[model samples]
Target: MTTVLFVHGTGVRNPGYEETFKLIEKAVHLERPDVKVERCLWGDKLGTKLNAQGASIPLYDSTLALDEEEEDYSIVLWQQLYNNPLYELQVLSLKPGDETAGNPFGEKPGDELNSRVERLNPSTELQAKLDVAGIAEVFEPARDTVIQSEAYHQALQNASEELGEYRDAIARAIVAQAMLDCEQQEKHPPILTDAELRDEVVKLLSLALGEAELGIGDWVVKPLSQLAQPIGTFYLKRRRGIITQSVSPTPCDILLYQGRGDRIRDFIRAKIEQAEPPVVLLAHSLGGIACVDLLVQQALPPVELLITAGSQAPFFYEINALYSLEYGEPLPDYFPSWLNIYDLRDFLSYIGANVFPNKVQDVLVDSKQPFPRSHGAYWTNKAVWKAIIPRLP
Candidate 1:
């Protein structure tokens, strides 16, 4: 059976896969039942795994860890004050002649017993105590040789780089802890009063932790398999005729593949090996770049047809000099039957419009008409399929 692999774009969450996959799958089944479809899933777990393996991932630092630490300190301080009831009474019960008594408008008789005695003197012994706790020694240098040696500077640089990795570890830990807390709390029966608010707070904390964990880094450079699995469920659904597919590879990632087209070509080659019939690559945005790169590297099977919508092929050629990258191996004098469908408004696809330097047949589908959404609504456009159906061998 013919195998169609659907790759999705970026910024997608798990829920998005569910909805989009269903649409693509339904469309595929209606059009070709014998064809096997697969959706690729790439999310938090995949992103994390890639980062752990030394891939550079983008992460967000919200200072949540620091804020949590500060809040915990404040809570402990407040609890200590409440526990010592005598501390409050000692300040309020001062009277004339008492050792701890204070003059109505002057320094107290016993500075040690007076809670507010520090407020009475601008430069007092109590102030020195606070300063010694490091609050006033912020500029002090470390006594260790490691802090002053040339090796120290090198270590500092290393530390700076490791901070990024450290924060990522902390974020992941927080997410895991939050998940465990949520599960534990759910086991207890509901308490009707203030517990409702507490429950809501717990839920919000869990979500925040998850966001921090997932935001640890960008996972694009990771292995395609890592990125593929999370998206697999969607592709699997598409294979089963449940959802529509969309692919948007990052610009940087596409650039990498353009230089070494073998990455994607190898992936497709593996899939072709798995199934007997040829594979159809439905690509969008930068995904088209990857497809072009693949075409240049190897003699791909007689691809039934190559379909690209809102693609960025022309930009690669136009700015090839600036990017310092090769346009793929030259296309054959007679290229594969190709359909390049694009809307005028989608500035992304327009980059390749009106130009087919490679001699590939370019069929522009005028989606300027008012029905389907312009940039993203490629697959939904009936005109798209009209152009595609005849070309499919």
Candidate 2:
């Protein structure tokens, strides 16, 4: 029997990533039922800022950096994650049939949510004690508690106060990091549409604003933008877990301990050692990086195979931060059999062919969605299944 360990990258996992693991297992089992699929949940090991018991944080933020230059302007890399607030406050505030204000798609200046509240009809048993109005009365205080909380006020105030500076930091981070000087950025910088600017302003005002840094040439700048973008998002998603979500001095064990993630590699190594041999390690996103780091940098026993999908190792290589390799060094001659696959739509996923040369087999899949959506699409996609089955023990 072959054991395949599925590793995850950045983002909050819904249902603690059980859905993800199951999806991958089903995808793989469709062809090979005897093979076993397991998940290495490292998202919580770092910790989270989300608190499900209190209220859902109305948190949504993404950052952009210049990627390539086009005709009149450069294209900025959009780093987006969908971590919505638990409940819809606006919907709860409105009557059951009220129409919301604006059309997001239409070319209108004003916009408001056009959704109406959907109240459930009371059951006969429940109606014995309370009428519809009585039920509404019972729930009204919960809504008030959410809106009137001191924490909510802090969140609102913090976002509003830092809005302007975060916007400046967004532009500055991109300009400084693009390897382009200030004058060059002014001349051919990426032109953002009104909607883009409006959205970025909120992101700049987001909880993640200060943690991301813009790279200025060879120098990296922090305190301007949060450089720990991935880790911050992961923390947000894992906020529902009790042990992981507690307010702490260290919000992210992964990013704060140095972006190389040695601690995670140690965990991965331990998992690998415990798994039955003839184990085929399957890693996604950051998990891929940790697995590679373990084998190359640490003295871990090699598994049967190393398969990675939607990984960011190629980008890490450019920074000379991949712990195993030296400056300009190709993949090590002793590196295990590795199969790397990626989706063209997930810009975060990079091609390793040029970097590792012939040492790595790179496969590209067409995930119709763009950007981060494509990043996790590999879990159930048929293309990913085909790639995994052939390499299994």
Candidate 3:
């Protein structure tokens, strides 16, 4: 009889392992009843722990740090701004503005905007401002993008005779949109490293519209600054407990195994040795990493096929971080036939065929779920079962 040795991923202790293992065992027996199934449950035996109850970490459970009133909100706000150039604009538009005084004697609210809107061409002289700002490459495309965008049109309709304020807001939005465009093309420069250069780009663009960078600062950031303080304090006070409860122990297992993996590899080897001939090693996540390292370091002739699902072994090897093998090193001749299964939605899953060439066979299966969820959805996926059952030794 053939032996199928199942090695589970990180963070899987006894009760959880039993539930997941039974699912696999049932799936396998339904198809290949003649094959004997075994398990190498290493997580419970060798997983890392906070034996000192996290005493080594500074301020592990302390909340006194929240008493400090000086909270800087700019860093987090700027990070959000970098990802979404129109964040401030979106927030401002959502907010309710104070009622404007009746202007019976004045032109309608948006009339002045209609007159000047025709002249608000970002592609013309603004291109020169972008060129001097060191992102000339994205100017035309960015300009076209903003002019055609629904947000830009909406902003134009909302502007009153407050031409200066609206123009300044529009100019900054254009510049920020240009930065986002450059990033999407994977050509973002290192301008943020020199804050002066980044500021100059926005300043120069605002000056083109005969205004300054006061609109976003006075109208948008000031209000957000007030709101961020209380929110930041609430999170700060409960951060330690929140992290303790939310953060998974899986990362600890990965780190411990990467740093010192002798026990995990040895445990897998012992399982392989005791299994019947034509043994197939089926592993997932970090277990897959340990199995790959073991197979590469030493030959186990009884192990005829190796299967990995949602594994980072290939990623580690490509980064030259794998414990047993370096990047560019060929797999040993003694290594068995390898099958790697991946789900595109599972960000943890990676392709090995390109890196290992002919040695590894890569297959894709969709779990129809978003990542983190997709990572664990493979076992329930029918395609995953079909792929493995046919390849079993």
Candidates by lDDT, descending order: 3, 2, 1
Candidate 1 overall Cα lDDT vs. reference?
Answer: 0.40
lDDT preference between candidates 1 and 3, better one: 3
lDDT of 2 by residue, 219-240 (tens): 1122113323343344234434
lDDT of 3 by residue, 64-104 (tens): 22221232444334434555566555654554433473264
TM-score of each: 0.41, 0.50, 0.54
Q: Which residue runs does candidate 2 get wrong by more than 4 Å?
A: 11-16, 47-254, 257-260, 299-302
lDDT of 1 by residue, 1-393 (tens): 666655443322432344445555656777777777665443322211122432343332211111112122212211222222121122222211333334546643323212221122313442343232212221111112112334223322222211332223222222223322332343111111112222233233223322222222222113222322232232222321111122222443455455654545556556545654566666666556556655645556645556677777666755662132355534554345556777663456744433456455565665432111234556545566677655554
The TM-score obtained by model 3 is 0.54
When summed lDDT is taken over every stretch of 10 residues in candidate 2, the lowest stretch is: 109-118
Off by over 4 Å in 1: 11-18, 40-249, 252-265, 321-329, 333-335, 351-354, 366-373
